[model samples]
Target: MKVSVVKIGGNIIDNVEALDTFIQQFAQLEGLKVLVHGGGKSASALMKQMGLEPQMINGRRITDAETLKVVTMMYGGLINKNIVAGLQAQHCNALGLTGADANIIEAHKRPVKEIDFGFVGDVDKVNIAPLKAFFEAGLVPVFCALTHDNQGQLLNTNADTIASQIAVGLSEAYEVSLKYCFEKTGVLMDINDESSLIAHIHQGNYSGLKADGVIADGMIPKLDNAFDAIGEGVAEVQIGKAENLLQKEFIGTSITA
Candidate 1:
């Protein structure tokens, strides 16, 4: 069987029209599929409203206890259920899930290095049996960025990493294609110019691109995970705009090992 694991981020979750369009397109996709989504700016805004300041280091959240609570409600509760409901409305059998549910993903609390990202988790294992069962039963699984330590504690995880890890885990049973949908069409040569999209990237040229500063910031980590997934046997990985979800041919930067 073939499967596509699609991950979406940015302000899409905050915009009703955009999210609805994306979900509609997603529902039209053929074959077994899964959706993994990131939390939007609303969580930070809610944290501020509750007197808790959101902190970040290099685009990764510093998930303290209070912030964890806010993200849990935002990612797992609001965003996950909303997407599932939207898919269901479109006649797709979508089931919302957190890593804690059915022990889909097990993680460990991030160790204290120079900075302490409290309540953050690094993925330790993924149980593929339940996910495969969902696929066999004709159910689409939608994932949130929250995972558990299997010790009764929920940990905040990165949605991008979760998506890649799921792709790697399911590669054993399926020909997997991982798509990351964001605001941009793809990784660009110039940050300010959308037309400067780099259509393809291979491991050989990645270092040169990074040296020239073409790939930096959050994109670097995202691509690193992409290449890792490719190395681990994911058939294809693409990063493009949300509209690509509706297209018959993929339009984005394709990653190669």
Candidate 2:
């Protein structure tokens, strides 16, 4: 059995047509096992609408007691369910899950040395048992990054980081490919030019690009997660558009170990 795990960005899910097209392609794949991780754009939007200001420190959402509740309810509840519904509408048997399911993932509240952000978590361990059962049963497991400890306290995790961790876990568990799908085609040499997709990336060069400001801001964390995934024995990590799927000719950056 071949597995391909895709991490869909929250921004991409906001666009109706793009989401539909992506789901349509996913529906067409035959004998392919998929695991999806999505984010909390709509959840944040609702929070803003309700006059609950969202705070961010170093690009990670700051989840205080108040914000944590909204995030868990929105991301793990509404957003995850909607993604599953979107896939199911296209006849994809998708099951939405949180780290709580079958103790699928475990984490300790992240204690940052430089900053204090309440309730944010760094994934300590992923229990892949439930995931194996779902995959074996022919169900696509879609995940929200929010997870809990043994005492059952909900904690926030970086969606992309958690996605990469889950991809790494799935790859280790099943020995397959993990693809990071997002809005950008790949890491670009020139930020403004879409055609400047760097097709092949060496781990050594990625560091210099960041130091030189070629890869900064959002791309910085994303590339960092990609490197982590590649380093952890995922066969290959490609950052690309969902439209291209697994087509060989499609342009994207490939991270090879």
Candidate 3:
């Protein structure tokens, strides 16, 4: 069976209209699929509202104890359930999940090196059995950016990493295509110009692009993960805005291994 693992970032999650449009389009997709989402900005906003300062280094959250509490409430609770409910409204049998649910994903707390990302988890394994069962049962699994260490500790995980890991794990049973949906059309040549979209990228040229400062910031990690997934048997990988999913012809940056 063919499976499409779609990861939607905070750009779509924080906007009601964008999220509604994206979910409606997602519900129409055929075959087995999974939806993984990120809502860090929403969690951060809520944290600030509650007087907790949010901190980040190189796009990854510094996930302190207090931040973990807020993130769990936002990503695993509010944002996840809302997406599930929205998909259900569109007639999609969606099950909202965290890494703890059914122990679908097991992770370990990130070890301190140069920086200590408190409560952050590095995925140790993604158990594909339960996920495949859900697919066989005609259900779509919606994953949030939270994982656990099996030892009664919930940890914040990077959504992109989770998506890539899931894709890699399920590639043995399905021809998986990992699509990262965000606000941009694709990776751009010029950050200031949205029209400068790079439609194709391969490992050969990726380093040059980075050296030129074309693909920097948060996109660097995303593309790095995309390439890694492709190398690990994912059939295809693309980065584009949510609306690209609804188009008859896909216009996005395609990553090649």
Per-residue lDDT value at 91 in model 1: 94
> What C-alpha lDDT, on a 0 to 100 scale, does residue 93 get in candidate 1?
99
Q: Show the colliding residue pairs in model 3.
A: none
Pick by TM-score: which candidate is best? 1
lDDT of 3 at 193: 88
Query: What lDDT does model 2 reach?
Result: 0.76
Tell me the lDDT of model 2 at 2.
58
Candidate 3 lDDT, 43-127, residue by residue in tens: 8789889998898888667988899999999999999999999999999999999999989999999999998999999999999
lDDT of 1: 0.91
TM-score of each: 0.93, 0.87, 0.92
lDDT of each: 0.91, 0.76, 0.91
- Report the error of model 3 at residue 232, Å: 1.0
Candidate 2 segments exceeding 4 Å error: 30-32, 57-60, 112-114, 204-220, 246-249
